[model samples]
Target: MGRTTIGKSNAKIILIGEHSVVFGQPAIALPLPSVTTTVVMSQTTHGQTLSSRYFDGPIVQMGQNLAGVAALIQALLTRFDAQDTFFHIAITSDLPAERGMGSSAAVAVAITRAMYAYFQRPLTRDLLLATVDIAEKITHGNPSGLDAATASSDVPIWFVPHQETLQIPFTLQGYLVIADSGIKGQTGRAVAAVARRKTAFAQETNAQISRLGQLSTAARQALATPDLPQLGHILNDAQQQLAGLGVSSTELNHLTQVALTAGAFGAKLTGGGMGGCLIALCPDRVTTEHVKNSLLAAGATDTWTEAFNLEEEHQ
Candidate 1:
């Protein structure tokens, strides 16, 4: 028997900016420390095995849908010079998949970290980013690299494709209420849809994308100044732009409206947006509770709240 190794990664959510980010626009993402994915690895006489809610069997026997994870395991094995090693990799996650929560990236990060630890090798941030990116490609077809980067980071990130990622400092003076629509989001399909529309309505689409970029810039400033109202306004504008792009769905709109009616400072569909979850910004804990209850009444499948305190965060 060999030594056991464990690794963990936090989930992530895009605070603002999604499809537009692909076109070199900036976006913001926050790490969800409360939600996480963990991977445990140990030597086994048998060939590679995986145990998770979705699958339980030899890694080779996993369905094609798991090809992304399979490719990641193989890559790690080769990188560590342990191609012949047989290990049982067990995965557990609290984050829901297909909800724009960076589940796949979190899994890849956790597994990759576990493998490095198993080999007693030093794992650098650069290596971790590069390695997890390979798996992200398998899952997202063409990821913006935002998910992987944010999943591995602890603080909020400001990302511009092909440029350096910046960490944004701020104190969250309010609460974010995340409400699930209970529908799976098709990120690849959504990206392709946006591209097709861009071709059909080049000028209109490009203008909207540019507006989203502008909103992201304003959002960055609001975050720095810790202006909750200004941030909320920017979010509302971003959602309107996203809706114009045709990514917003009826369910998402309904939930967003409900949250707003319930006194949320701002509300918008997060992630790929065809279907997934929407986030509502509440000015305080009382408003957060009101919105959460209202979302439940409005048919939200699930809801969770994250509170932010800049003073505590700095400490």
Candidate 2:
């Protein structure tokens, strides 16, 4: 009986520690402004219809892998079918699908939030995150549950795969420059590959992840204290761990080197990493711009800059 609309949540880039996180290492992720998804609801005469517009592909096709999302809507409709709560859902996002940037999670968060608003109910972050996790199963199969957590709450979070999940509201200093390689990474395949490899190299991988996790704790403390140099050092170590996991691509490696050579504070391949994007931690705008220029010079297809803050936004 009431219309509802939910504001979008931004996607994220792992500043450091990728595969290491899978083994229980700590990773630093910062939300990006360029990628976001919003859900809008309005009164209609028919049943619920989901419409999404993405950066690429057809708009209607955006719902291709959103089975859990569809299921959630169906369940709601069944519960209120008598009222026939006619709803029209429209999704618009800057996040690209399958890029390991938490696009699907953003959509799921927005959808759940909108649904809550429709019923004049309070929306809790936990409820929004849980709904997104269900949808993640369709897209990521066995996702690490990090992306949804990040999208649901915009901040630097510490997730220990299967061990622990916590959020640290540490305000980050300086800017983050990200460059897309125009190569899409299959997160499902990458996660599956890592799981398969775990059986053979469990001891070694677990040890590395544990080390990364310990280092991550120190890094978290450093982040809280706002020490940029120490944070950069941890990022360098985390990148090495990710490389050892065999996720870093040659192109991504080249990009990382280029950023480092250009005087970037820290640089590493982010996301699923067989291909995707690289995030460079820069100490200042000057360095960030320098790294960005170097990335473009080295054939990076797209580049974006964002300033991350741990403080919540004013509604």
RMSD of each: 2.5, 3.8
Worst 10 residues of 2 by lDDT: 53-62
What is the per-residue lDDT of model 1 for residues 1-315, given as tens digits with 9 covering 90 to 100? 578999999888898889999898999998887678999999998688999989999898988778899999998888778889989999999889899999999999999999999999999988998999888898778777788888898889999988968777877687888889989887778888899999999999999999999998998889879899989999999999999999999989899999999998899989998999999999877788899999998888988777776333310
- Among the numbered candidates, top TM-score falls to 1
Once superposed on the true structure, which residue ranges of model 1 sit more than 4 Å away at CA?
A: 310-315
* TM-score, prediction 1: 0.93
- Give TM-scores for every candidate, taking all chains together and pairing residue i with residue i: 0.93, 0.85
Model 1: per-residue Cα lDDT at residue 86: 84
| Window of ten residues with lowest summed lDDT in model 1 | 306-315
Poorly placed runs, candidate 2 (over 4 Å): 1-4, 54-64, 79-83, 192-207, 310-315
* Backbone clash numbers for all candidates listed: 1, 0
